[model samples]
Target chain A: DVKVTQSSRYLVKRTGEKVFLECVQDMDHENMFWYRQDPGLGLRLIYFSYDVKMKEKGDIPEGYSVSREKKERFSLILESASTNQTSMYLCASIPSGLVTTYIYFGEGSWLTVV
Target chain B: AQSVAQPEDQVNVAEGNPLTVKCTYSVSGNPYLFWYVQYPNRGLQFLLKYITGDNLVKGSYGFEAEFNKSQTSFHLKKPSALVSDSALYFCAVRPQSGGYNKLIFGAGTRLAVHP
Candidate 1:
């Protein structure tokens, strides 16, 4: 089975602290994405990467940044963690070649900012 | 802008009864619609998708959705509800025009199954 793993399951950080949430997928997929989940908003894409060292901004990319240094690893960064940034972060990936309907997701990382 | 809508914020149903979660989408060009379910404190799980062909798409966990082009609706349905089926459901749309992974999601609907 394809697996997407988020390294950090839970974290607590002070305001203004730099934070990192790492995700790794074994699917060798070219398309990877980072999304934030809130109570009412569902999942909002923060950023996505088509390949290593390539990134694209999504709808809510203002407070977040991402890195795709390697194909299997995609990292989401909060330069300065804030209270509003406290939410469940999800990592997903899909094969770009075919008209595949599946997008595998990581378990999720819950970040709490104080 | 392309978007999807889940009209209900929450739906309540008793065990052994049928249940439905409503969804409608508005987008340019052909739309690829999908349904997902998220258990508490977990990532969203793909339930079903409608790419082409059949309007009735069966998916994981005994869930199915019907794609209605005329109404632009893809409503998820299940014959019998179970207590374990209570979860947060989301409706999403992928535009066929551009951006292969650009998925626009709706404000989810919470399903509650009472035993």
Candidate 2:
């Protein structure tokens, strides 16, 4: 079984603070993604990394950045967390670039910015 | 633009009754469709997927989905609904031709099963 681990499942941060959410996949998946899920809006991709040091912006990438220094770990960084940034963050990974490949997701990190 | 649509925001059914969560998508060429379930405060769990071959795909937790090419639909279904089956269901799509493609997800539907 594949396991995607998120460093934190629950977090509370103040406005204008820097936040980091981390994810690590047990398998060697080439593609990793970060997404913020909100009610009605659904899951909007923040960033995705295809390989180490390679990143791409997704639908909503403002105020967010990603780091993929290693194959197993992917991190999402918020420069200045705002109240609106409070949402559930999900990390996902697929084994390869195959279009038919299904993704595995971490438990998710719920960020609360006050 | 490629998109996945789940018409119903919520579906309610009694336990032991059959349940279906509708999902339709619009994308170019043949697309890969998937169904996922998200429990409260958890990430999405892959339920099933339709790539090719069979239209009916069975997945985890006794769930299944049917792929209809003509209708561009891949609706998730379950033969017997259980109270534990209640969760937020999402439908996703990925176009077969795109290079380094990203998955698109629907807004999601909430299922409520009562005994």
Candidate 2's DockQ is 0.77
lDDT tens readout by residue for model 2, A1-114: 999999899999999999999999999999999999999877889999999999999999999999999999999999999999999999999877466778899999999999
For DockQ, the strongest prediction is 2
Q: Model 1, which residues run further than 4 Å from truth?
A: none
User: Which pairs clash (backbone N, Cα, C closer than 3 Å) in model 1?
Assistant: none
Q: What shift in Å separates residue B113 of candidate 2 from its native position after superposition?
A: 0.3
**Runs of candidate 2 exceeding 4 Å displacement:** B99-101
lDDT for B13 in candidate 2 is 98
